[model samples]
Target chain A: MKADLVKTLQKKKKQILEIWMEKQLADAGLRDDLISNEELRIQSEELVQALVQSITEKNLGNVESSEFEPVYEILAGISLSRAKQGFSPRETGIYIFSLKDSLLQVIQEEMRDDPAAMYAETIRISKLVDSFGIATFETFIKGREEVIYRQTNEITEISTPVIRVWDGILALPIIGTLDSSRTQVVMENLLQEIVETGSSIAILDISGVPAVDSLVAQHLIKTVSATRLMGAECIISGIRPEIAQTVVHLGIDLSNITTKASLASALRHAFSQLHLEVRKKQKQQ
Target chain B: MEKIPILRMGHFLLVTIQVDLYDRLAVNLEADLVQMVNKTGARGVLIDISAVSIVDSFMGRIIGNIANMSKILDAETVVVGMQPAVAITLVELGLPLQGVFTALNVERGMELLRNRIDLDLNPEDDDDDAISDAD
Candidate 1:
């Protein structure tokens, strides 16, 4: 009985492919921007070929069986590629469901003479297609997660920069919320820069930071003490009025830390610590 | 009984910790350092831990104790030549070595001690002012 269904699917493969393409192209969720119609046709054709080749009598009902590995692999490839190409999850879902629709139409036409056989085969086919659809969605989500993970790593790497503003002075402007891990990165980079430059003064400008609470205050203190242990004075600048109010309200003791209202004032303090003066040259015409 | 020798350099006592310290050894060193400070009447103490790699909370506390003891005995303590890894470990362990002076190396440590001692000794001369207004 399963042999006859497989044979019918094999014989009507071209018709199934044509109908599937038409269904996909006519769907409102079809994404022409992410994948062209010709590329979509090739993907659909490859998946159909793999599906027909892998279906056997023993495991036709079991989509999770090892016999269906080739079919799953092709489906996974198409789903992952679509995810990376920025296709919406709904669009990818609709792509697989449309194939199911096309196959059922072909099955109904082939088994028209036997109502009992047609009903049973339609149920089996629907179950198998449902499993494939779920697998495709799983792989699509995995691919999107990988993209997000890579972007997060890149952001952390590029965001923290230790700049040597002057001789014996290093500046680190933190631009985001301070967490324990990011604080570790900030301290390591700042301390390393201090050692390399032999800078006696460091200015931590928190101007870009969006908020400050007790946790951030503790992180700043840790950073300051670490710099002190390295024999460099850390001056925290860019204490916005709101952040200052929060710090005072939280009653976090920043009294021991030398803080300035802005980076310019912090630089001036650094110069004084170095016993250096910046004077403008006389104007010449 | 192994002993870490404390060398007297001028008015400063210099200690170089060349081995990873166990708890007992750290306590012994702290005790020995305080006794030596009293015996020598040293005006400054410089500790070079560039060779010591690991520092747990116990070791950190011992270092802090050494600084406190020397402070009470009227000798300023300057911890010098701290490895970056050791400093990071100490910070992570939540021991900031508060009120203890630190320098990059022994030479800078000596300079710091000298500057501090000079400032301490010159207050009266500073008040004496203008060298008696003489040429």
Candidate 2:
């Protein structure tokens, strides 16, 4: 078994194999020594990445995205998450990031007349595509947002139901459990929309949120911080009791931020802060 | 509209609506669905449109309405089986459910409904009577 393993290692890297030979002669345990070598470690990582790249590049156009499951995990764990998914303004931008090109390509290819099924698929892959990639994230989010924008051709930039309100308030009623990438998109869109709208308050109501994990909690914090940089407030609403527990257990401190039990309550707070009250029709719905 | 009983267990009523074209039904689907949901009397509902070829702004609005109506009636609504173009269309249109439960697939939608609505034999609230179409 040892000889076979070494033989396999030799095929991958002769230089590492030479180093392994020296370490083997000096050490009593070959398994630990071989694995702990810096050269072999680098070689293994390179080989793994190369293997994945070859698989992805070769089969990207031919196979369905589901066929690239192993690649997605590797991408998420490897270069994409480790080096690319960095925090800070430098990484944020106006772009659509999508790693699953196979799915996106299919959607774009069929968008003309076969739009109904295409829209359906967009929702399907929107769930699968990693929310981190600028291209993928943009495609995923814009795909969902497109329908809303296109609904009324006469809709002004400011009239969309979900948008940044005046007085630095961004009323975004979160509809689903957040993952890291979607969190990024939300952060990006909110910040950009704030810059454009000059809003001071961002009320995020997650009452619709069904589950909350540590990552989700972290994403929320990051969103809050990002909003703050744009000189705006991010008010969270619809925080369920269970979500509150998850936030606390995960050691997320949200004390300084404004939170409400529901969107109605948050909007009331927003109006009160703005010192404005509605007559009836505008506030009725 | 092919109705597949994905989840018929207890309080969970999972159904996949095969909309080869959700667009074809977008015009009246929203109101029709609200009525169908009320008629079904299911505490939890999932609409699977995996076979749908596209999703538009009107389609997205219908989804949003379904979610809101579901909540008003104390029922949970989940939109499932969306494809890639549908995702782009939704984001572009910006009409997805603001507070709706959505899943990648039908099975996940079932799991989500199961998690939200406690399936018990004891019907404490007359949830069925709450479905209101009053405009």
Candidate 3:
């Protein structure tokens, strides 16, 4: 009986491919903008061929067996690529479930004369397709996570920029919420720039920072101390009025740190520390 | 006994730590540094630790102690050439070495010491003038 079912699926592989493609294209969730109809047809054909080739009399009841490895591989590749192509989870899921619908419809027609065999074969085919659907979902999620991880790393790399404002002064303008991990990055970059430029003064401008709490205040203090340990003076500038009020209310002691209200003032302080003056040229006319 | 050599340049004492300092070596250096400050009447002490990589809390305290000891002897202590990692570790250990002066390298350290000495001497010159005016 199982052998007949495998033979029946093999004979109707092309029909299953056509029905599956029709169902996917008809679905409201289909993303015609992301994938062309020709490409979708090729992907559906490949998956149908693999599924029919892997369905054998011995393994028809056990889709998890090694015989179905090729089928699962094709499904995983399709799902992962769809994920990368920006397919929604529901769309990718429907692509696999629609194939199951087409396969069951063919099996139903082939076993119409034998009611009990048709029922049993329908359950077997449903279980096999469901397992394939699960595998596809797993790979889809993995692909999406890879994209998210890459974006996170890029944000970290571009966020912290060390700029040399003067010959002996380096400025780092922080523009986000300060966390401990980000603090380490900010600290390392500023310190490395200080060493490379041999700058005697550094200005940490926080004008772009959205807010400041005790934790951020602590990170700022740590960075200042580290710079000081390297024998360079660190001046924190661009203190918004609200941040100052918050610092005062929190009772965080910043007495030792030389903080200015703006980057210009911080630069002025740095210049004075280096005993250098920026004077304008006398009017000659 | 392996001793970290301390070199004297005029009124300044320079000590370059070329090896990882164990507890015993650090303690010995601390004691020896204070004694040298007393013996030479040095106005400033410059310790270059760019080569020293690892620093525990014990090392941090010893550094603090050295700065305090030299300060009591009327000599300033300036630690120079500290690695970035070492500085972060020391700060995390809660030993900022508050009283100790710091410089990026030996050249800056020397310049800092010269400026500090000049600043200190100029006040004494003003005091001397004030006393002469009183007389």
Top candidate on lDDT is 3
Sort candidate 1 into its docking category: medium
lDDT of 3 by residue, A161-225 (tens): 99999999999989888889889999999888888889889999999889999999999999999
Candidate 1 chain A — worst ten consecutive residues by lDDT sum? A55-64
**Candidate number of the best DockQ:** 3
DockQ of each: 0.56, 0.01, 0.74
Please say which candidate is ahead in lDDT: 1 or 2. 1
> Where does the lowest 10-residue lDDT sum fall in candidate 2 chain A?
A87-96
TM-score for candidate 1: 0.91
- Model 2: what is its DockQ? 0.01
* Chain A vs. native, model 3, TM-score: 0.90
Residue-level lDDT of model 1, residues A1-285, one tens digit each, is 546999888888899999999988888877898889999999999999988888876788877899899888998988888877987777778788888899999988887888898888889889999998899999987876888999987877777899999988999999988898888888888888887787778999999999998988899999998888877789999999999999999999999999999999999999988889999998998
Arranged by DockQ with the best first, the candidates are 3, 1, 2
**Model 2: runs farther than 4 Å from truth?**
A1-285, B1-9, B22-24, B119-135
lDDT of candidate 2 at residue A13, scale 0 to 100:
43
Which stretches in model 1 have alpha-carbon errors above 4 Å?
A: A25-36, A84-86, A282-285, B122-135
- Per-candidate clashes come to 0, 65, 0
